[model samples]
Target chain A: MSGEQTAAIESDIEAAIREDHPALITYITAGDPSLEDTKEYVEALDCGGSDLIELGLPFSEPIAEGPTIQAAINRALDAGTTPARFFELVDELETDAPLLVMTYYNMILQYGSEPDVRPFVERAADAGLSGIIVPDLPAEEADPLRDACDEHGLDLVFIVAPTTAGERLDRIMSQVSGFAYVQARLGTTGARADVSNATHDSLTRLSAYDVPKAVGFGVSEGDHAAEIIEAGADGVIVGSALVDLIAEHGTGDAPAADALESKARELKRGARRGGEQRNGHEQGREEAPEPEQP
Target chain B: MSETESNPPAEDEPNRERTFGDYGGQYVPEALMPALQELEDAYQRYVLDNEDGFMDEFRERMRDFGGRPTPLQRADRLSKRYDREIYLKREDLVHGGAHKLNNALGQVLLAKYMGKERIIAETGAGQHGTATAMAATHLDMPCEIYMGRTDVNRQRPNVYRMRMNGAEVNPVDAGSGTLKEAINETMRDWATTVERTHYVIGSIVGPHPFPRLVRDFQSVISAEARDQIQEQAGRLPDSVVACAGGGSNTMGTFHEFVPDSSVDLYAVEAGGSSLEIDQDEGLAPNSATLSTGTDGVLHGAMTKLLQTTDGQIVESHSVSAGLDYAGVGPELSHLVDTGRVTPASVDDDAALNAFHRLSNLEGIIPALESSHALGFLEEAHEELGDLVVVNVSGRGDKDLETVLEETENRDLDAAPDVEVFDT
Candidate 1:
């Protein structure tokens, strides 16, 4: 973040994979409960073994969110979360893990407007943010933001839905740099009973790319994380489950942080188990050291 | 060589690359992309292809079920007042009482062809919802309609009509609890149930393919009126007018006349109070996207929308539920940019006056949405030609409750001393 250029998000994932573990990415609404506690939660999630943390800048209308994340966003908005405030929170955040901002495209489009340029990318870069993920901005409409992100040396992550067609998939995979986000189901984000077979099939289609892939949306439990990682995902993203924890346990209590940390460890454990199983049968593969569990 | 092959293919605008300057694009989540692409392909394959007989079947439904070729009536009394020949393209005579059934029946048929088992739509005034429910019942398919809770309260009779037709009505309470919020809920439902569901978008204002497809289905209104005006008036009318909510009725009433350069096209928007008022007050004008809104994205398409400087979509207000949206269709925005269409605004009070005037003068109860078009007649340029055609887009049956309430309120305000005790 200083004189030395920050490591690319792919490099961070590679390093984690070299240690025989798939990355565990966690998402939380930045101002849910409170913005002050949000800063503390980021560091705690990192300490708890999360490889990356995605800060969801709350919006008034979250069209793609289910009831859980929608409630989190409503609470955050009620608590007064604005783009300026979220950027200030990011500027003050102190964490070793890579930080990414997740929001709708309009939120970024509104914050800064120039002729054929995105100001949000430069603002995010100035805030020491590593990457950005906009759920509504597809590859067909991502050129301006992608160019801005490239100029700012920030990663612009793209998503791959289960129903993504072949040609559209090729277009989406072309520009994404941080990692490709793989939606685990055909719907909005929420906890579900099981991961669909379509996810594995979609991963098989995406396996042609060198980019790390993270499975989100309904990857709530440890087994779900393991299933996705085993199906060839490089990481697992757990959002609603983690946000629900903060919602259930008051953010003022220590048990909230403890519960979050414990959930992070469980997901990391599943990721590691999946990674081991991937290379266990191949004795010719290089043996890697394991990172300590939380 | 085949006729189509020899003809070098007709220039198809609907099938053209989808964008309007910087407005219309896929702004939806990745999960809905595949379904959108699939719908685009199916639409072109089944509905757009005239040789498939699919469009013939759709036209049959429009004739037998929807009572197509709605009469073009002369508004002689109103014409005398405005000093012009005003003819009303009476879409109110169509079954289900509005121009919405044109798009609804077309899409519901397409859904049946695509093997979808469920259909869903979002509505504000309940015209589109009732139309969709009617189409679903005719096809014997299950239907669900999402309405804003606020709108459901005001539009109770339509709610009962939908339920009576066996369509489930879901009242959405999020956001301003209006058309835009209902659209969000319907999109959510489609994203989750794309495997077996078809979303019958009510207007021409969503992501690509939808805007194009809906406009195509509704183009029949102008097509019929164009022929009728030519036969009766000896030429195309001097001006064509309709109210703009999401711009469907206007687009339908304006498209065929677009190529006729001599004809002027005017789109009347719902000016709730006035265009200059602050939108946050909940009393400001609505459907003024071309007049007061800036370029932005809303409900998946880039278009002119009422939004804050920070890009939050603002709630729009109108006495007429059908014309109460905050955004206009992308194509309408494009037409405005190119100067092909003139956008005018009529406030709620003026629209109500026109509503009662049309009712008393012509013995026709006009929907409030249609009244906006009639209200614009008062401000027509003095130099314009005598013949003008305005689309009477819907009947007023569904708005009876709201109209009665407003009439009572106006009467009370007119006479403060009058008081009646409950019997």
Candidate 2:
């Protein structure tokens, strides 16, 4: 876990996908149903199919979400999830998976950019996480925040929206190491059927940039995952669908937890087919109508 | 019948998410999830078993506590000018001084029955804030009010009254620092502490439960207005006019009446200047949602919103702070969309003039927001000399400071009679 180099990060992700296993990104709330669960989930995801475990820090207001997602957050918060707990969870989960943490910007602002955030990124590097994903903070807004993730030799992963301007994409591609998260819609994350045409246009437009772009939000099951990969995306991110699965299964004791873990692993098995075509859409299609102020 | 005795919900459980035809659901943040679920279960049970007797107590409270059947006062000066009889529902006479009390009293009592801890609410002009606090005080429950900093600066009297009633008033200083901002701030709070807090939203907006709950509490308005108007005039009024913010008051009074098309139900919006004749988006961006709002989702529900090509929530402004919301309630949106209701708006000056005119001529300080209803008196009058009822949703005492001779003068002074509006 210690003495991890930056080059070691990219190759690790490349190596994990080459295997028959779907790279599991562990998703635990920073200070959730309990931070103890954060530690538990990270360890579980690492032990299971999770290749890149993502630590999520909750905010009083996560603007980019719908009611269902919001309710899950509430239950987690009621259990007392927090920033310090997030660090502790990562500190304990010394796994081989590259720890990729995700959260809204305000949480970082509340915790601060320098000593507080930098050390956490360094800890992730130590704990074997490859990067950090701040979905709301794009590349332009990344500089001040990016420095901390970089200071620890951790890849600061930025997200590109369906509406990200071309110039912003180029700028983000140059600075954004690790893998980039391409949001599926103009608005916040939620589950929906059918990948919108706008998503296709974004991938084609961003193809010139040579970064590993993973299409996330609404990509569920192996079919959808394979379809996104076939659409030319480097990877597919399964969030709401997976979150829904975890919420359903992962709620009780060890037996119940193991039962949930099997289902989660089963989900990743389907995630591998994401490299093929899904539905009928070919590769890229032009899409418009992006929601304002994501 | 003895209170809470024998009477039971129509079905086995309370109608948790149903509100008449077009109201009710829980579209809120995750934190408030458990609370909404719990309350929905409780409200369904209580209302069904006690609804009949509850009305009796409601009437007693309205009569003994809230000044019953609040005068069907005739505004002769206004009526005379219109060549028709104009009647004011005089909701302003209610205790806490506005129609807001009708819904506040109903919900606060519901909260008490459910055994909730705190009453959380959001307000712009402080009318609903003050009214909710009054009800909470009577029930001896802890209450908290969220008001935008801008509204506190303007509606000082109402703000002070809310504080005096032992309600904690938290000033919101975010985005525009007004009603919407207060709503945003309250939402953040509700999402964080849903377990112990009953978010008593002031209007018929937000997701599901709010629109429905607020409407049920306010349905008493139309129930009373229907019976009262018949008793007073020997027949229904030709038109029922009320100002719309989230449109709860209007819907409450209009719903029971909407089925009566002969009763021309009209809800007026405060056109800050004019419902944007051209598209320049901003706070004062010309608004006319019912007049021009599109079908979209906002706050949490799919309804009507004043947005752009890209569904961005637009900032709306009006001389009446209460009527300055960017979106209308879903029921109203459905009403307008279905042509079940006719929508109207009066620019800042017209509403201001109506406010002062009602104050000086009738010796009644009508809420500036309600003045938008008064602003339509002449137009509403044109159709008939038949009975016309305008819901005086609140007292203008909170607005007297601003709508004086110098009223929204700048907009009114330079403006020509709105051309879009043809006589």
Candidate 3:
């Protein structure tokens, strides 16, 4: 809180996470069609140049989640996926992606939601994971995760929104390291063609800060990815879109790992292109000459 | 995700957009969404049934069993010292020894009519559990009560009483071993048993229809106070004071007073130890809902809670177990935030001292929870003269163990504890 991640994370927010110069983040649920596909998709995103990846593990009663996530969870649960199995698969994998595995608190608590976190975390780093975001577990209760991330040098990501307060931001920022996952809006995970201007303004507002922030929960295509970056976001995360891709490419075969690999490649390409645009814009702002002595 | 057009109709009461004015709305799991909507619809239709039948049935029980017209008596000694007319609504005098009987009877009756099979309840201090168990047993409905392990041990007598009354008791060990955990356990149980089980939430802290329904059931206190003040003192009291643990009595008395601009509603909370100590106590920690809570949520209902930065539930402390809740009842949250209700805290020492003072001066033994109300009187009664109504939610029997330990060997008349605080 006093030193480690705040100063470094803050500057990133204004230019990186904000829509003005953003990062394009893409998401795919773990064990969605199958565990193999989920891991493969994460690796594919990394290979394709996506800035960040949000890997979701399905749960039963996701009280805060919307219909899109609810369906993804059901599909995963139907495939015999559990938090324990998800963590196990992540432990076994060797990916070159920064994995942000998200899941519920109860499921986490039920099955080493704490003890099991350390392994995948270290493994994620080996495989190239940068951060993690679990929505249901609020920042205050994120005990072991905060400590684990510090010990392992992994990013324990925190989510903030327009609805978040200044006082709260300080506390949340205290617990998280790496970068903040700034939600595009309030409510559960979903994507919509018509994004709110207010949402965009909030992302832009955050970009004015210094924390390296990532925008998540929507942004379907190359254009949307480009828009988030232009608005100052360091990362633009696509989830339901990738889930849609997995649904399209998936077969009833074992794991469906290829589906995720293919989807991750496309999302990573789009998101990286967005990040490049952000870096370019920030450079432009930097290179802009001092105003001519009026 | 986008918030939809789900605000309830704007009425005079305009409940936090659900209508009880900042006091009511829908906040629950998606699984329970349809059920909540159905309950709201059923409640809407029942408002039409203002059928004298329900009201008449309520009065019948109040008179025959539940104890009707809880007396409005003056606390003679305190009144004289403060120069204010401090009248007490003796909900404590009711058959089950608390105000909870009023709501329990009302809810069980509603269940009987709704054709629910089994009844499930959550108890913090065990008062609500005991009362609900007694009522359901009286009405021949199967009852189950979930209590946190810590509470069950602290409030052993009530736990034993509930078990004896033929109610099954499940002890939960989650969260901070208090009401919040009890509530979470009850919610899970309700989801499993929702179809046949009528979750008679003890306080106005759950989803929509509950805040409104429990308040409606308990509102008789204020209705009577309005008439009692006119009949006895010839005017409405200037200020209404009640201890707010999950806020049943406070809501009961304040409901009639809230719409009355002239009458002030002040809810007293447990302020354990000193201001610093009180802030640190979990007896319902320094949850300044009325002052700080916006229209967000913590528990199952849309109420005020002292949440962590990432929205984790914070534990609260009060010498009074019932008030040892993390969240305030929804209406109380609304009342405090919207400027309709004024909330203040009295630390445990002040309440304990006042507890002794009441025993000495008025010869009336007050529950530790209710001592909070008197603590307010001892502190601020100088300004409020000739007009104050206090709700004595229960007898000191449930709190006798703690009382004896705190104020042991210190007495005025020493009426032998009355075996349960005799009138």
**Leading candidate by DockQ:** 1
Tens digit of per-residue lDDT, candidate 3, span A1-294: 124634454322232233322344667777777776665666666666554556776644444555566567667766767555676776666543345667654333334223244654565555444556666455544566577766766666777755555655667656556566776754456667845464586776665455565666555666666666566666667787767766766555534345545655564456556666666666687875442111
Return whichever of 1 and 3 wins on DockQ.
1
Global lDDT of each candidate = 0.82, 0.65, 0.67
Off by over 4 Å in 3: A1-294, B1-11, B14-24, B274-288, B291-295, B408-423
After the best TM-score superposition of candidate 2, give how far the Cα of residue B45 lies from its true spot, in angstroms: 2.1
Task: Tell me how candidate 1 scores on lDDT.
Answer: 0.82
Clashing pairs for model 1 are: B23-B302, B272-B285
Lowest lDDT sum, 10 consecutive residues, model 1 chain B, at: B1-10
| TM-score of chain B in each prediction | 0.93, 0.87, 0.88
Residue B363 Cα positional deviation in candidate 3, in Å, after optimal superposition: 2.6
Indicate which candidate wins on lDDT. 1
Residue lDDT tens for model 2, B1-423: 112112122433244533324322333433344455566665566654564466566556767777766777777888787877788888888887788888888778787777778898999888889989998998799999999898888888888899899999999765567877687667766654555667787888876566767777777777777777777677788888888778988888786776666778788887777676343333345445678776544554446667543233567878777787877787787777667788887777777667767776788888878888988885556864478989888887777657543443445432234333434
Give a tens-digit lDDT track for model 3, residues B1-423: 122222122336533235455444444433344445556665554432544376677678877988788889987877888877889888888888888888898888777766789999989889999999999988999999999999988889999999999999999765456787777667666644556678888988776778888887898888777777767777778898999878888899887777677888889887654333222222224434444433435444556655432233456677788777667787787678678889887777777777777778877778888888888888888666568988888877778777666554344232245345434
DockQ of each: 0.64, 0.03, 0.03
- Shift of residue A76 alpha carbon in model 3, Å: 23
| Docking quality tier of model 2 | incorrect
